[model samples]
Target: MTDFISLRNISKCYSAAGRSVFALKDLSLDIRENEFLAVVGRSGSGKTTLLRILASLEEPTAGEMRFRGKLCSPGNPLPSGMVFQDARLMPWLSALENIIFAFPPRERTAELHEAAKKMLETVGLSGCERSMPRELSGGMAQRVALGRALIKNPSVILLDEPLGALDYFTRRAMQRELIRIYLQEKKSFIMVTHDVGEALRMGTRVIVLGEGQMRKEINVDFSYPRPRSDPRFQRLIDEVLDAIGDGE
Candidate 1:
């Protein structure tokens, strides 16, 4: 359980209306190998900013990150894939094509199609390979997006509210799908979500953020398909809600 990725004194700032705005402040975290880490907070809590920094989509204003003991920055980021709330698939591409689109054109070998097909199966969408984005259900389209990320064979996967668009049952199903993929791929999965229960159910460890800093950390310390009715589970949820300043 070594550190796969480490952030040291990370910070992000911007100037708005002639005033400095800090999106993240002295936020430090260590992501371990094969662990599912969930980040929870209310709006403007810096959750998405943290994920963006990890993905190299945004550079931190201060501090640094290390991946596998090597320094990482926007120019030298961790080998990772990112999935957004929207599937963001090309409107004209089929499921198979969407997964293959992850690679650059020159890297799109005949072998890549087979790999994409395998990834589709991995995400539980084997027979829907030829289905167009418009033809797939919300969950199915999101699964294709997941396959697109997994096909890259990244060391870590960053999820930014990827299931927020789904209905209740679909969201639950996707949660299980995500866990299954996490175990099977053995890669670090870092997700940002507003749902406290969702974080408690899926994360091996949960980190709570408020006003750009971590307020609390909790360990699930149990097996998957977490029992929501268990008193321990309820208690942890309560603790997390309180940490987020929403407990009443």
Candidate 2:
């Protein structure tokens, strides 16, 4: 497939104490449509920085990004949805209202309410639309956040540790749910996670980053619901850990 989104020699730098900090250094990547691309690395390895740049939340200090074929910047960000570690739901809004909030005020009609209701069902929250964020469980709240992102129907979805705060069981369940959603929506998904195993399970392709540069790229050819005990899966984990300099 041709590149759906392309980043060419992208770099991001920050200034602290009159000194420069390089978050990403000359990184280039291509994302294809209908694929799950997982990014893995240690803290400060630029995984989140790259996702931010892709989301157009941050501008690259150098280089450029092209979506489809046109250049994109902070002023003209890509058409995409983003989910962070925290659900970041509005405490005052019900689950249904939170999703309706994705639309502009003028667009929030009765029809829109029906659409949001469908979205809640899509995220497996059909009966909980009346619940507040505080009332929902961590996974359910994150599902609401996912629903909010999906309601807009963007071509790409950017996930930054969206399941990081959930318990082990919930996290695993969310991982499966994410895989299901990615396949059902047939959209490009760029997810950044610290867990090598999670990356292996969820990504069609995994990119390992170190020191703000691409260390390795691994293609996961197996089907979804991959067995963790499989030798191939374990080997891929080892390879990614080695790429991240953690396999020693």
Candidate 3:
């Protein structure tokens, strides 16, 4: 498979209190087309910063990124769409309208509406098109956000701790929903999550970020709908935790 996304020698730094804080240092990664990759890390480990750079939301202090073998430039419509930790939906807009917000307003208004509604349905929000963000539950709101991201039909999807705020059941349900979408859409997915188990369950490959760099990469190599109690899955979780220097 071809490389859909590539990052070479990427680094980011911010000056704080007359000192420099290194968020990422010399990180290099390649995401193959249609691959589902998860990045797991502790707070301040630079996972979010890496995703921001990939999404073109922030420029890296050093190194380069390429999309579809083309050099990525500033102001480029990133070959990807992003979902943040919060739903970030406009409170006044209905679910369908929020998804439509990303589309260009022209003769395609009706086409965009149809696409948005289809995406909402794909995310399992079929009948909630007219629902406002305030009227929806947290999981429902996040589903709307997912619909918004998918409606754009980007080649890659960047999820920045998007499932972090949900309760256990909702979070698990969303994880399965995300996996289902990944399989159905076959679009590359790069998610930054702190949940190790979720990472193990969802990612075909898991990358661990630690101490200002990517510390480990583990391939799950298991079939989909992975069971939580499987020995291999549990072992992978322990291994990822150990990579971050965490104890059992």
Candidate 4:
């Protein structure tokens, strides 16, 4: 696999209450193309901080991040789009408009509408283009959010707990949707999810972090639509739980 993103000795620290708080410490990892990398860890493990640093939303206090052999900057950031836990859609915008808003306002045109419409279809929201955020269910709203990210045709997509808000059934359905999108789009997707089972179900490789450090990296060799009842699947979950020191 070709390396898409590489982080070398990445560290992030902040001063809070006269104490130096380190979210990440001397961390290094490589994300390859077309890989679904799930990041799992306990609270304060710096999972979200890692994602934000990669997204260029936060500046790392130390270390370097390179994308495809080039240094990354705010202007020449990683070739990716991001989705948050909440759909974060514009309240007044239609689903299609929400997708279109991902592009710059200066770049908005009739052509972008057709592009958004196509992405809406791609994300299984074919008939809901005109639906406002108020009219859409939680799952449907997230679908719109996913559309916004995918519409950018990014080489990588960063998701920070993108499905944590949905109902159990809706979350399961969206999990399948995520796998389907990953396979169809073949983009490098790094998702930071608290749900261990969700990570095992979706990721090609799972990275476990603890106390601001990488604790484990496990490769899920199982195919999509993996059976949790299978012994291998359950073992993987156990391994991840153990990594987070929450074996259960």
Q: Give per-model CA RMSD.
A: 1.2, 1.1, 1.4, 1.2
Measured against the true structure, the TM-scores of the candidates, in listed sequence, are 0.97, 0.97, 0.96, 0.97
lDDT tens digits, residues 35-68, model 3?
A: 7899999999999999999888889999998887
The lDDT values for all models are: 0.92, 0.93, 0.89, 0.93
Clashing pairs for model 4 are none
Candidate with the larger TM-score of 2 and 3: 2
**Mind giving the per-residue lDDT tens digits that candidate 4 earns over 43-114?**
899999999999999989999889998989888898788999999999989999999989998867778989
Cα-based lDDT at residue 146, candidate 2: 94
Better of 1 and 2 by lDDT: 2
lDDT of model 1, residue 7: 94
Colliding residue pairs in candidate 2: none
lDDT, model 3: 0.89
> What tens digits encode model 2's per-residue C-alpha lDDT throughout 1-248?
36579999999999999999999999988899898999999999999999999888889999999999889976778999989999999999999999888887976676888999999999999999899999999999999999999999999999999999999999999999999999999999999999999999999999999999999999999998898989999999999999999996
